[model samples]
Target: MLANKRILLIIGGGIAAYKTPDLIRRLRERGASVTPVLTSAGAEFVTPLTVAAVAGTPVHTQLFDLTTEAEMGHIQLSRSADLVIVAPATADLMAKMANGLANDLASTLLMATDTPVMIAPAMNVRMWDHPATQRNLATLKADGIRVIGPNEGDMACGEYGPGRMSEPLEIVAAAEAALSDGPLKGKRVIVTSGPTQEPIDPVRYISNRSSGAQGTAIGKALVALGAEVVFVTGPADVPPPEGVQVVRVETAVQMLDAVQAALPADAAVFAAAVADWRVAQAASSKMKKEKGEIPTLSFAENPDILATVSQMTKGRPPLVVGFAAETDNVIAHATAKRLRKGCDWIVANDVSPATGTFGGTQNTVHVISDDGVEDWPKMAKDAVAERLAQRIAGALVG
Candidate 1:
C-alpha cells in the first residue's frame, strides 16, 4: 500500500526509541523510503549508527549542521517528505509540538513541515495517564495529528499500562493509511454502525443480533481511503476505528439526531441494525411479573433514518447506502427497500440462523441499485466492507 512513499520519521526521546530500527525496516519492507531524524534524548536510547544501518541512509541530528544546511536547508528538509511520523513521542516532545515550541531540530522540522503528521506515543504509564499529557494529546488531535498507540504492556519502568509503542507492523499499517492516495481523499462521509437499542425500561431494551463487525470494518476501509469519516455508532461489539470523529448513540431516534447533526456529508452509509419498533411508553422503572400477573407492552415504529436522510431536499448526501438483513427473498426485498428508502444502494444479506451472518465474520451480500442487483460472493465481513467502500469511492469520484 505504501509503495514508493517518502516518510520523514522523527525519533522522540523514550525507552521505546530502541524499537526505531525495526520500525524502519518494516516501513522499508513495504516500499517506503525512510529519512531518519534523531533527537538528542532519542539518541541516548538508540544511536544514529543503528538507525542509519537499518534505514540505509544518513540520519539527521542537528538543526545547524553546515554540511547538509549548505546542500539542503531545514525548510527543504521539512518539505521533502510525503508524511512525517513521530515514533515514541515523548511527553516533552509532545508538549513542545502542541505548544509550538521549536527549540530543537525535531520540533523545528515538525513546525515547518506542512506535511500530514502521525504520532506513536510512548512514555511512563503514569506520565501517559497524566492530565497534562492528555491535554497535549487533545491539542495535537485538534491540530489533525493522527495517533497510533501507546499500547498497554509491562514497561521498562516495570509499569503496566498504555505506555508502550505500537508494534512495527502496526506502525507500518498506520503509515500506509496516512499515505494512501485513495479516490475518497478529502471527502466527508458518515457511517452508522452497530445495533441501536430502544429502551423498554431502565434496564430493558429492544435490539438486534448485529455485532457491528461490518460497520466497523467499513469505517476502517473508508479511513484507509483517506476520507474524513464521522462514525455515528450504537452499542457495538467492536471498538471504533482510530482517526475518525466518533459519535455514540443508543436509540434509533438518537442515531437519527446524531446523523442529522453530521450533515453535508458526501455520502452516508447506514449499516446499523436499527430496531424496527420501540416501546410506546416505557416504564420509569424495571417491571417484574408478580404472582403470574403478566405485563403488557405496546410497540411504536421507529423513525426511518435511511428514508429521512435519503429523501432530504436540502443537505442530503449525494450518495446514500443502506443495509437489509432479510430471511427470505433477499434480492427482491432489498430492491424494494432501496426504492422505498430512497437510498442509492442497498446491501442485502441473508441473516437466517443457517447463514450465521448476524454475529458471524463472513457475509454473503447482494448489491441492489437502480443499475440492478449484483450478487457478491460470500467473504469475510472486512472484505465486504472494503469492496463497498471502494465502490462508494468510485461513485463519489464519478
Candidate 2:
C-alpha cells in the first residue's frame, strides 16, 4: 500500500531507539522508501552506521552540515517527503515542537514542512504524565499534529505505565493510515472498548482480559479520518487519544448507558469485551470466606449494549459493528452474532488458549459482513483497527 511513498523518518532520543532498524526494514518491506534523520541525542542512543545499514542511505544529522546544506539544505529536506514521521518522540522533542523551536535538524524540518506530521512518543511514565508534557500535547493536537502512540505496558525501566512507544510494525501501519484520504470527514463515530468491571464488593470486581488496544486504535483511526469520535472506554492502561470525546465506565450497565448517550453517530463499534453477567446481588461490603468451601454466588445477565444500540430508535448509527470472541466454531459464532445483534458487521477473533486473543498485543480477525467474510492475517491490533476504520470510512463516504 505504501509503494513509492517517500517517508521521512526522524529518530528521537529514547531507550526505545533500538527499534529504529527494524522500523526501517518493515517500512521498506511494504515498499516505502525511507529517509532517516537523526537528532543529536538520537545519535547518542544508536549509531548512524546501524541506521544506514537498514535504511540503505546516510542519515541526516546536522541542521547546518556545510557540505550537505550547500546541496539540499534543511529547507529542501523539510519538503522532500510525502509525510514526516518521528519515532520515539521524546518528551524533549515534543516540547520543542510544541513550542516551535527549530534549533535542531529534526525540529527544524518539522517546523518548515507543509506535509502532515505524525509522532510516536516514548518516554518515562512520569515524564509522559507531567503537566508540562500534557500542556505541550494539547498544543500539538490543537495545531493539527498527528500522534500514534506511547502505549501503556511494562517499560524497560521496570515500570508498568503509559510511556512505551508502539511497536515498529504498528508505526508503519499508522503511517499508512496517515497517507489515507480522509473519507470519514465530518462523520461521527462511536467505539466502546476494554473489559467492563462489575463490582462484586468494596474491593473485588468481575472483569475479563481485555486490554482495550484494538478498540482504542479504531477510535484513533476514526479521529485521523476527521471523524468526531465518542470513545466509551472501561478502565484502560493507555491514555485515550487526544481529539476524541471520551466516556469512562466500569461495568456493563455503565457501558450501555454510555453507548446510548453516544448515539446518532454515523458509525458505532462495540469492540469492548463486556461481561455477560454480573453478580445477582452485589454486596456493599467485602464478602468474607467462612469455611474452606467456596460460597455459592448467583449470576444475572447484564444489558446487551450492542443489541440495544443496534436497535435504538433515536438517531441510530448508520453502521453498527460488533465483536465476537469464540473458543470454537469461530466463523459460525461470528455469523450468528451478526444476525442476533442486528449489527451491520461483526469482527471475530479466537480467544482460546492457543490464540491468546484476550490480552495479547496481536490479533487475527475475520471481518464478517453480509457480503462475505474477509480473513485478516495475524497483525498488531493497531493495523487491524486502521484497516477497519478505512473500510468504515469508505462505506460512510460512498
lDDT of 2 by residue, 76-159 (tens): 878989889898899999999999998988999989998888888899999987999978877876576766666678888888
lDDT value, residue 49 of candidate 2: 96
Please list the C-alpha lDDT of all candidates, in the order they appear: 0.89, 0.85
- Name the weakest run of 10 consecutive residues (lDDT summed) in model 2: 237-246
Residues 244-293 of candidate 1: C-alpha lDDT, one tens digit per residue: 65667899999999798677789999999999899999989888769968
Which has the greatest TM-score?
1
How far in Å is the alpha carbon of 36 misplaced in model 2? 0.8
lDDT of 1 at 29: 89
> Can you list the residue pairs that collide in candidate 2?
none
Pick the lDDT winner: 1
What overall lDDT, based on C-alpha atoms, would model 2 receive against the true structure? 0.85
Q: Which stretches of candidate 1 lie over 4 Å from their true place?
A: 124-135, 150-163, 187-213, 227-350, 359-361, 364-383, 394-397
